[model samples]
Structure formats: C-alpha cells, structure tokens
Target: MSDVSTPDPRQSRLFTASELLGYLVLAAVIFIVLPSVLDAFRLNLFGKYLSYAFVAIGLVLCWGVGGILSLGQGVFFGLGGYCMAMFLKLEASTPENTSIQSTPGIPDFMDWNQLTELPWWWVPFNSLTFTVVAIVVVPVILAFIIGFAMFTRRVGGVYFAIITQAIAAIATILIIGQQGFTGGVNGITDLRTLMGWDIRPDSAKTALYFVNGVLLFAVLFVAHMILKSKAGRLMIAIRDREDRVRFSGYNVANFKIFVFCAGAAFAAIGGAMFTLQVGFISPTLVGIVPSIYMVIFCAVGGRLSLLGAVYGALLVNWAQTTFSESFPELWLLAMGALFIAVVMAFPLGLAGLYDDYLKRHIDRLLAPVDRMMMRRAARKTSPKAPAPTAQAAE
Candidate 1:
C-alpha cells in the first residue's frame, strides 16, 4: 500500500478572492469614507503623508527590492521642489514688476542677497511646461548619471549609502551657499500660487488633496505592476545573488540603474506635488535628515510590501503631527523608540506581519473548500479498475 501524502496545491496561488475583497473594502474606507469625515486640516495632513509615500515608494524599490541603500532621495526631492518653487517665485515676482536683478524687498533672505535680476537658469523655469517637465526629467537624469557611474563601478552596500548621504549634504550646503539664486539657508518660501491657482483658498486645497490622492493611487498601481513583472523578478534575483544572476545572462548593472532612476523620478514627482500643495519650498525639506526619515518610513511600513511603505509614511507622519505639537520635547524620542521597536519586533515590517497573519486566516477559512477540490481532482485522476481482472476471477 502506498502511503504517500500529496501536498495541497491551492496554497501556491497568490492572493485569494476573499483577500482581494478585503483589500478593496479597506481601500474604499480610506479613499471614500475617511476623506468625507476628516476636516480640511486633517485632509491636508493626510495629503502631506501621501507625498512622503511617494518618497517611500522609491526607497522600497531601491533598498527593499534592489538592495540599493540610497540616503539621498531628499536631494532629488528637493531638486524637483526647488525647481517648482523657482518658477512659482518667478511668476509671483514678475507680475509685481520685480526684475530678477532688482531687490524684491519681500523675504528677508532675498533682501539680504542684495540682488534682483533673475538668474539665466531661472528664466526657463518660469514656463509652466518647463517646470513640470523639469520636475520629472531632472531627477531621472541625475539618478541615471549617478546610478550609472556608481553601479558600473560596483559601488554598493554601506558605501553607496554613505555616498548618497554625502551628496544630500552637499546639495543642502550648495543651496544654502548660493544665497542669491537659491535663497540661501532660509530656502524659498512665501509662495502664493501654483500654476496660477490660488493655493490659499479652500477649494484649491481640496483640489490639491484629490490630486495627491490620484497620484498616490497611480504610483501604487505602477509599483505593483512593476513588482509582478519579469524585470521585478530579475531584480529579486539580482538582490539574492548578483554574481549568479550575472552568470545567468543578465546585465545586473542595467537593472540596478533602471530601478534607481525610476525611484528617483517617483520621488521627484512627490516633491513637486508637495511643493504645489504647501506653496513653499526650503532646503530643510530636502536635507540629510529628511532623506533618512524617508527610509525610516519604508522600513516601518514593511520594506518588502508597497502598501507597507505607503502605510508607514502615512502613519509615522500622522504620529509626528499629532504628538509633536503637544509634547514637542519628547516627540523625537518617541518616534525613535517606535522605530526601534518595529525594527526589533517586526523586522519584515508591519505590512509583512499583517500579510502573514492574513494569509494564515485565509488558509484556515478556505481549508475545507481546498480539501474538497483536491479530493474531487484526485478521484477524477484516479486509475480505472481493470475489467480483465474481474473476468478472470469469474
């Protein structure tokens, strides 16, 4: 008698229908019910979280999936933000008949610079089309060049992270030093409008919130698709064993650069959207600290899951906003402790834990159905009795 126990095949398929329904229901609650109930301030705060989500997406792609630790996403984010800020500032200044060469006599930093004429580079940014294009293109180009050089030279791991941090530091310092052009340490602020729309109005803020929501959805969808594709599989392979992948006929360098560039571009888009909503841009927003914070968001959310990155960014930022005002002194410490706890307890991240728990629940719920299907399949595939054996017996 054969005593082999066949394994159930139902466990192998990704995400069951009930699981999908649960996700859809959860999404509906967030995108539909929450917005309707939340006040404008809360909605705006959520919008800011969504911007952070954009940066977290990049972190997940590079660090979580591609094994590239980039500590300089803030630089790219700042670059895109400042680009938009420049155009907005130029537009606001020009209508008031202020020449780039003359002192605008508005912000203290610009006043102290003792300069008026808009820099040559600032001219193109005044064009809305140019600003929009720059927001996406500039970061991608920069990432491509930097990533191409670094990956080609085989610079990775902690060294790559250090280089990225250094770049972010340099960028912050450069923006601070170029007082005349970049508004120096004070950065750029006192923005009034974006693409000619009044940012101060409730309607505009609401519109901005919806825009952010749509962008977040779009980014999440794209990320999900990429993660499920052949290229994504190759990325995982490279992450697991780079040399083996190289030997298996894949150009590891190209894949790394591609993901790096894509992450940068996503960050830039988020930065631009953030600048538009906030109606302000500053170097502080794009410094080393913020870049590190971006990584923290991804780590806390569950680096391996795209949804985790988004959830982490939103949850962490929400906590910062909620507690920092009331307990300013303890806020940073609290955040740090929370991060440590998450890293220590849930190394796979909150999303990973949630997913694992969900899978277990689903397996239990579907066990009977799975067993029934397996039995039916087995019966159908079982061998028929031999008629000759019966006739011989008779």
Candidate 2:
C-alpha cells in the first residue's frame, strides 16, 4: 500500500480552521460588536443592509459558482417582500383600526382604490403560516419555471441576463399597474406589528437586527456546505465547461435549474426580512435597477466568497448612504465612479485582494494555531502504541 494516507472526504466538506475563524470573526462583528457600538436606529439600518446581503450571496452561487447570471433577482426579492407585506398589512388592517374607511377591514391602499372586499388571493395571506411558506416557495417555483424553459432550450449568457431584466421590468409594471391589489407606486407601508408584537419600537428593532444576523449566518452555513460538496464541484465544472459536463452524462440543465432556484430562494428570504426590517415593500425594489445593484454587490465582494458578499453589501450601502446624505445631487455619479475604479483596480474584488496579498501573511500568523490543531487531530486518528505483548512485557 502507498505510504500516503487517503484524505477524509467528510472532513473535506467542512470549512478549514482558517475559514472557520473567518466565520467566527464575522459572527462576532454582527452579533456582538455592531450591536454594542451602534444605537438601535443605526443598527436597524444595518439590518436593512444585511437584508440585501441575502441577494448578494445568492448571486455568488448563481452567477459566480454556477455561471448563471440573473438580473431579475429583484423579482424574487420583491415577491418575498410582497408576501410578507401582504400578511402584515392584513394584520394591521383590523376593522376597528380602519373604521374611518369605507372598507373597514382591508388595507388602506385597497380602500383608496375602492376595493370593497379583500381580493380572493389576498385571503390566503391572512394566515401567517401560508405567508411564510409562500415567501420561499413562490420565488422558487417561478425560478423553476423560468430555469426549465430557458436552460432546456440552452438560452443563456447575455441573452439570459437580458431576459431576466425584462422580467423584472414586467414585475414592476404589474405591481404598479395593479394598484388596488399591490399598493401601487407607494407600495405597502405603515406596518406596525407581527404576531401581536409591536416591531416599530427601538427595542423591537434591535431584536429584529439580531434575528437578521442569525438568519444570515444560517444562510452562510448552508451556502458553505453547498459550495464544499460534490454538487458545488459540479457547479464549478459546469461554469467552466458546460458542454464537457453534458458530454460526461451529467444533466447540465438540471444543475442550472437547481442553482437558479436556490438563488431565487435566498433572494426571497432576504426580501421577507427586508419587509420586516424596513416596514414596506415597493415596486421600486422589484425593478431592473435594483437587480443590477444586487449584481454589483456580488461583484464588489468577490463573487466567489459568501462572507465577502455580506461585507460588500454592508460597505457599498454604507457608502451610498453617506454619499447621498453629504452630496445628494452627486451621489449617483460618485457611486458610478467608485464602481468603475474598483473594477479597474481590482478585477477580482475584495476577496481577491485578500487571496492575492493578505492570505499568505495571515496564514503565517496562524501557522502555530494550525500546527496545534493538526497535532490534536493526528493524535485522535493515530493508532495507540500496541500494548506490550505478554511475552515482551519483561
């Protein structure tokens, strides 16, 4: 037998000690440091930004790993937001609260639009259970249909991206045009409570922020697992050479469909959380522009790194907020210039920067820690020294 030992497949699926440390650092920042440093209001704002991290992470899986670019992630995000919004709107639209309106039990926007009775479809959302299910299922189903129709026919590349953008435009138009049903241009707003919990207060908002952070880490774990598995390997292979994967008897379209649906599911969860954090869902969030913004988030973070995508969302949004406040008239121009500069200077993004320069130094610093861990693992796996035989005991 060869002297070299075979690597552990199960161990290979887990993150390395260095990678685990990175995750722990992020968790500390989110759960401990940020909450301690920032007040509730700023923390709430960060919660909103973290919501966008969901979409960015999805883009990493779809566009980065799978090589399936989708510009309509906003559609999935919006759908989730709307689902949650619809449920919240129903909860807030108590007949006693809306006694002033002609329709005493319906949403204010519906009342304004002369909807006498709740729409048939809106009735199901009255149940929170259904709303939660729909948030993930609805977007995934739509993604499945689209992925099936497009991938089966081999429709991809720039063409696939443009089609997704068009879908976003259509979704936005539909939401706005159906004002009575969807809250129209203003979108759903003035959400106050969830399951009888008043979420508008500072204390409540802080709680929600922690919840968002926990959920984000959960997503990161899932994404990391997917990326470390055989499926992840196949995705990378397909991204590099789809024809070769197909020729090898793999169902390329099915893999594409799965990843696309997964991306949509992730975006949808983000949308739902966004509605909870921000108190609204708008047509503006479901349009082509927002979809493009999501892609930019992934690209800026290093499309391949899940943790990088989260940081990208937080940093980019922070800059946008700062610029918009300081230079309201020129913020958009500044953002455009910033993006151009980043792309020109660092083609691979923040993660790429770390890999190229920082990783080696960091690894060197952690070498001792790594060695200790390896020693422990070897001790656990190595055979105990053979017990001295009875005859040899002397």
Candidate 3:
C-alpha cells in the first residue's frame, strides 16, 4: 500500500511541496538572482515591472478563476498610485520648498493653476497613514460599488467588460481635465523624497525593489490561500456555470463582488508600489490602453497560475523596453502579433506550455534516476538474506 503520509501530487491540498518550491524559486529570483546580475537602474526597472505583476495576479483570480474580465483594472491601479503620489507630493511641497510660488504650501501644479490653497480632497493625503489606508480602501470601495451595481443586475460577460472600459476612459478624461488638481497630462513628477528620506539615490531604489519583492510575495501568499479555500472552488464553479451555481443556492453575485474587490485591492497595492519605485503616477497608466496591456500580461503569463502572471508581466515589459529602444515604431505591432500568437498557439500561456510539454519531458528524463534511487532504497531496507542464517553458520 502507498504510504499514507506521502501526498499524491494529484490530491488537492492547501499547499503542495512543488507549489512551495515554486514560491521559493520565485523568491530567490526576485530577491537574489535578479539583484545580483542587474545594475541598480535595471533592477529598478524590473521593480516597476513587478508592480504591474500585482495587477496580473489579480487578473488570475478575477478573470482566470472567477470569469470576471474587468477592463477598468487600471482605474484601481491609478487610484492607488494617485493616493501614494498625493502623499509624496504633499511631503515634497513644504512651504520652504515652494516659497517662490503664490501658494507656498500647495503642489507646484496647483500653484501654476493659480490655486491659492490646497484642495480639501488633497488635504487628507497629506497624512501618510491616511494615504496608505486609502491606497487599498479606495480601490476596494470603488470595486465593491461597481460589482454590486453590475453583478446584482446579472450584468456580466461582454457588457461588463465594455462598462469597465468606459469607466477607465472616463477616469482618464477626468484626471486630464482637472489639470490643477491632478498635475494634468504632465503627471505628478519631480518627486524627490518620501517621509523625509531621499529616494533619488540608487541605494534607496535598490532597497525599494526588495521591499516591492517582499510585498509581492505577501500578496502571492494571500492569493495562494484564497485559491486553496472553498471560496476559490465556488468561484470556479460560478465562472464555469453561473446559472447552475445560482440554482445550487449559492449567492453568485456575492462571490463575484468579493473576488472583484479583492482584485481591485491587489491592483491598488501594485499601483502604490509603482508610484513608490517609479516616483510618478500618470493618467496614461490609467487609460484603456494600459488596462488592455495588463490583461494581455495575464493572458501571456497563464492567468490560471499566479507565478505565471508575474513572469508574464516581467517578460512582456522587458520585451517592450528592449524592442522600443531599437524599433520603437514596430513595438506596438510586435506586441499585438505576440498576443495573437500566444492566444492561438497556446491558450493556457507559459504555464500551460510547461505543463503540456516541458514538465512531462523533464519527468521522463528523470525517471531512470528516480527508479535507480528507489531500487537502492529498497535493497537497503530489505532483510539482506537473513544474515546467512544462524543455523547454516554452524
């Protein structure tokens, strides 16, 4: 009989050894390998890429797992980023620093627009505590509102996606129109310090990169837990057959809302981290284009796998940077072609490729070694010919 303690790889559990190993490998890459190989600049760039990994991960849960394809994810990302940027902007806009401006205590953009005082909404962001809370809370609240309004009315699929895209467009327009309050098309730039610490130095940026990695792992852990839970299974059920799940007495709408809000929270955290590492937040990152790019990231990464999502975000952004430098005009076309190829050739993305081809081949290649080890183990545990028999020894 098989050892009861040894878990079958096929068995569903809270955490598998292979899954843990995946996490460790990812951690090593993010925390050790990448940092060792890359210079501070490149590492910072990767950190920015990792920030978007947050959105990709949330997509795994929302779109991949729950079948909720929100095209306005950038809205939450921008909200979180704006919250962090607001706080940093405030800290940088001390009266002494802005002494030349008409409004010595407000942001430079506000001053440029002839604003004599800080707006009431901007006042709360002055407190870092408030800003930190708002980063997650603001996005979640918005997600909850949107989810409730749509899901309750049984609105989903293409219609929900279109609505979300519309929201993203509206958000972009508002931010651009409110030039004085939001820094307009120029965006919130020239960010110098954070809580009195100079964040401009390479060392500080390196430190922030590690912090981003740590936070990403934390989010990954949370996502893993959610995936292993009953709610996660229910989410899959809801995604596959919403009507059947509803008929089974589960409140399908509630699950959808919860997952959507959770996804928004994840995206918001990523955005906040992006603001911290990149030192700026813009409406461009909040528009429909960036939102679609995020979905593509998830799709290319294998939306069903959290780690795949992270890899997807990193690889795609790295490719964008590399190609943009050489063939800037063709990068968009290249990206589009890449996406089509991935969807048509490998619907499951990178993770699926590994499982379907690479993983099986690897296991086959290792089979002989595994058998040899097992034989050796069995021989060692055997009786060894009964020690040549005590009676025959005489």
Candidate 4:
C-alpha cells in the first residue's frame, strides 16, 4: 500500500510572503522609475496628468462605484481653484490699495467694467486660511446638500446626470457673466504669487509638483483602503442593488451622500492643486464641455477600477496635449474617437482588459501543472495501477 500526503488546503488559496514582497517591489520600481525616466517637459505634463488622475479618482468613487453619473465635477474643481485664486489674488494685491472698490484697486476686468469695490461676499475669501478651507469645505457642503436633496427624492440615473450637467452649465455662465468679480471670459490672470512664494520660479513649480505627487499617492492610498473596507463593500452592494441594501437595514441615502461628498472633495482638492500648478483659474475650465470631458475620462478608464481612472486620465490628457499641439482642430475629434474605441473594444477599460488578459494567460499556463497533479493523485489512489502501463500511456 502506498501512502500519499494530501496537499494543504491553505496552500491553495493563500498569498505567500514572497509573493507579497514581489508585489511591493514592483510598485516601488514603478514609482521610482517613471518620474526619473521622464524629461522636465514630460514631467510637467505628468503633473497635469496626476491632477486629472485626482479628479478621476473622485469620479470613480461617485459615478463608477456609487452608480451616479456626475457631470458637474468641473464646477467643484473650479470652486476649489477659484478659492485658491482668491487667496493668491488677495495676497498679490497691494495692501495700500486693497479695496477693489477703488477705481485702480479693482482687477483688470472689474476696472474695465468700471467697478469700484470688491463684493461683500469676496471679503471672507481674502483670508488665505479661509480660502484654503473653503476650497475643501465648500465643495463638500454643496455636494451634501445636492446629494441629500436628490437621493432622498429618489432622483437618480439620467435625471441626476442632466441636473448636474445643467448646474455646471449655469455655473460657467454665471462666472462669465460676472466679469467684474470673476474676470469674466479672460478668467483670473497675472497670478504671480501663492502664499508668498513666487509662482513663476522653477523651484516653486518643482515644489508644487512634489506636493501634487504626494497628494496623489495619499489620495490613492486612502481610496485603496476604503475600497477594501466594509463600507466599501456596502457601497458596492448599494450600487448593485440599492433597494435590496435599503431593505437590508442599510442607510442607502447616507451612503450615496457620503460617496458624493467624498468625490466632490477630491475634485476640489485636485482643482486647488491645478490652480497652483497653472497659476491661473478661469470660467472656461469649469464649463459644461470640460465637465463632460471629465466624465469621458472616467468612462474610457474602467469606471469600477481606481487604476483605470488614473491611467485613463494620464493617457487621455497626454494625447490631448500632444495632439492639440500638432493638430489643434482634430484634437477633440481624436479624443472622441479614442473614447468610442475604448468603450466598444474594451468595455472594461484598459486596466480591466489588461487584468482579464493576465488572468486568462496565467490560467492557461497553470493548466498543465494542474493536470499533472491530478494524474499523480489518481495514480496514488489506484490499488493496482501498473507502472509499465502508466509509462506507456505517458
């Protein structure tokens, strides 16, 4: 009689330490190598891409994970940028002529419009701390109010999308209309300083870039942790079946509102970072078209995957920058085509496709080893199997 030891059940499904170590090593290599290999111009481009990635991460949580298609992320982003811009403007403006109400004290557009003083509401934004806090807090508050009203009323799907889009459009119009206050069509420019640092300096640009990089990683890590938590699982459940989750004693409205507020805050933070990098903020940046484009990035990237959002933002923005420089007229068309192709061919987005492809390839490669193990088990179990017969069969 032959005795054969059974394979350990735990061994079949567990991740070994070595495997975990390998994954960590791979991530480290990517983070270290990618920036080092790129040139300064490319690095700047990457900074912009990272900002877009931040926005996309928020969209993934709200729209992709939560089943809400928000087309007004640009408005939240603009709000953050405008808040930062307000601080920068206040800091840059001469204290002697601080009153924008005076003829020469107003911004160029306001001066052009013959406006004398800054609006009352703009007074609070003069404080840098208040402006910075408003950048984050205001968007969240707005998101909460909107989400509460909509979700509680059971307004979702297309109606939600349309309402958000309309909100974005109206915001753009209002900003443009208030030329004296917002700088109108030209937006805000001549932004030379941010928190007393000269924005035009390469050193400041590099510093901002580093700050952006840290924020991106921080946001990504937080998102990764959330997606792995119980709340994240409940979010997924809510997305899949809101009615069921509601019946299961979960506060579906609260979950939706939380996700929405979180997403808005993410977008707002990205916008603030973007304003620092670009040294300007404008109404066009928050227009309906740009907001729709933000949605396109999430769509082209796998909505369900965080990595997909990041990659989509990076690739699409890179393509836009490159193609727009060479063929400005065709840039939008090219982007639209690319989005269509990704949706049609990879429905899961590039990351999802890559993951599925890798999984299938690994399964295929392991099939032979699995068959060998099964054959060995059969041979050990057989009472009178002949070695010569097995060798002949082999």
Model 3, clash count?
0
TM-scores, all models, native as reference:
0.85, 0.92, 0.90, 0.82
Which candidate do you rate higher for lDDT, 1 or 2? Answer: 2
Pairs of residues clashing in candidate 3: none
lDDT, candidates in the order shown: 0.80, 0.89, 0.90, 0.77
Q: Give the C-alpha miss distance for residue 389 in model 2, angstroms.
A: 28
lDDT of 1 by residue, 275-319 (tens): 878878889988899998899899999898787888899889988
Pairs in steric clash, model 1: 100-116, 100-117, 100-118, 101-116, 101-117, 102-116
lDDT of 4: 0.77
Candidate order by decreasing lDDT: 3, 2, 1, 4
Model 4 lDDT, residue 123, Cα: 83
**Predicted structure with the largest TM-score when compared to the true one:** 2
Off by over 4 Å in 2: 1-11, 371-394
User: 2 or 3, which is superior by lDDT?
Assistant: 3
What are the clash counts of all predictions, listed in order?
6, 0, 0, 2
lDDT, candidate 2, at 365: 85
For model 2, what is the alpha-carbon lDDT of residue 261? Answer: 93
lDDT (tens digit, per residue) of candidate 2 on 213-235: 99899889888988988899999
The candidate that wins on lDDT is 3
What TM-score does candidate 3 reach? 0.90
In order of TM-score, best first, we have 2, 3, 1, 4
